[model samples]
Target: MKTTKRLDLAIQKLYTAFHNNTLNPECCKQCAVGNILDHTDAWKHLSDNHGSTTLNYIGMVNQKFGKTFNGYSPLELLHIEAQFLKACGYQLPLHHNNKKPKNPTDKEVLFLGLSAVVQFLCKLDNMPDVMDCNQLFQFQPQIKTSKALMLS
Candidate 1:
């Protein structure tokens, strides 16, 4: 399947971050969108809160001007972060008292987060999810199954 340059780069960076133990849901510079933007925290300025999808004044202005960071609009970045955090077991808005993963760097946790982010990225580009394996289960058998054989 074909993929946009930006999406491919984002996926690569995210995979690297996850493997390097640099992916963190609580850290702006290490979050999903942050990693996609090359580990920059500048995207944080686009939103008032860590896990919020609402754009602040600066974010709104940038969106109005049709600006993009690594091929993602300000709103898209926010949504990506929110989705990552949620999949990593973080509560929205990311309050100190809110629920979060016991170990944010756990491979299992980060994998889930990355999976969600990758799926969202695919959705943005109108592509089938890269993390989806349901198709693998849809393979047709070379020989048809007989009802009688099944009963036996």
Candidate 2:
């Protein structure tokens, strides 16, 4: 999956976060979206420097990538977070106000998650855009069965 330069950087960071097990309330509270949106690019006008909100970014995504995310929204993200957190038996810490001062829209949260997801899946499968095929992880069992197989 392709993305604008800044979004790509953000997606790559999210990819790294996943591998490093760094997804947490702190990062989410911080610039989860801002991490990429704040970058500088002379040719690009979509950066946060332009006073664009998360909704603006989402609209840009829909514009750039077509309507693949037309039906996806922030409610979907809240529910996804709730269900996944519940299944994992982890609970988000309680705060008087959980949202950050620059609270991102639900759609923005979903977009952030999705960008991470796409980069993650691409990394896992060695998709041409994000990872080298040789770097793909080789499961232990699969390694035992395949010749010249070892940890990626």
Please provide, for model 2 over 96-141, each residue's C-alpha lDDT reduced to its tens digit, 9 standing for 90 to 100: 3433324333444434554544544344334544433343553233
In candidate 1, what are the lDDT values of residues 1-152, reduced to their tens digit? Answer: 88989889999999899889888888889999889998899999998899999999999999999999999999999999999999999998999999999998899999999999999999999988888876557654455469856887
lDDT of 2 at 55: 32
Worst 10 residues of 2 by lDDT: 36-45
The root-mean-square deviation over C-alpha atoms between each candidate and the true structure, in angstroms, is 4.1, 12.0
Q: Give model 1 RMSD, 1 decimal.
A: 4.1
- Each model's TM-score? 0.89, 0.26
Report how far off residue 18 is in candidate 2 (Å): 1.1
Error of 2 at 7 (Å): 1.5
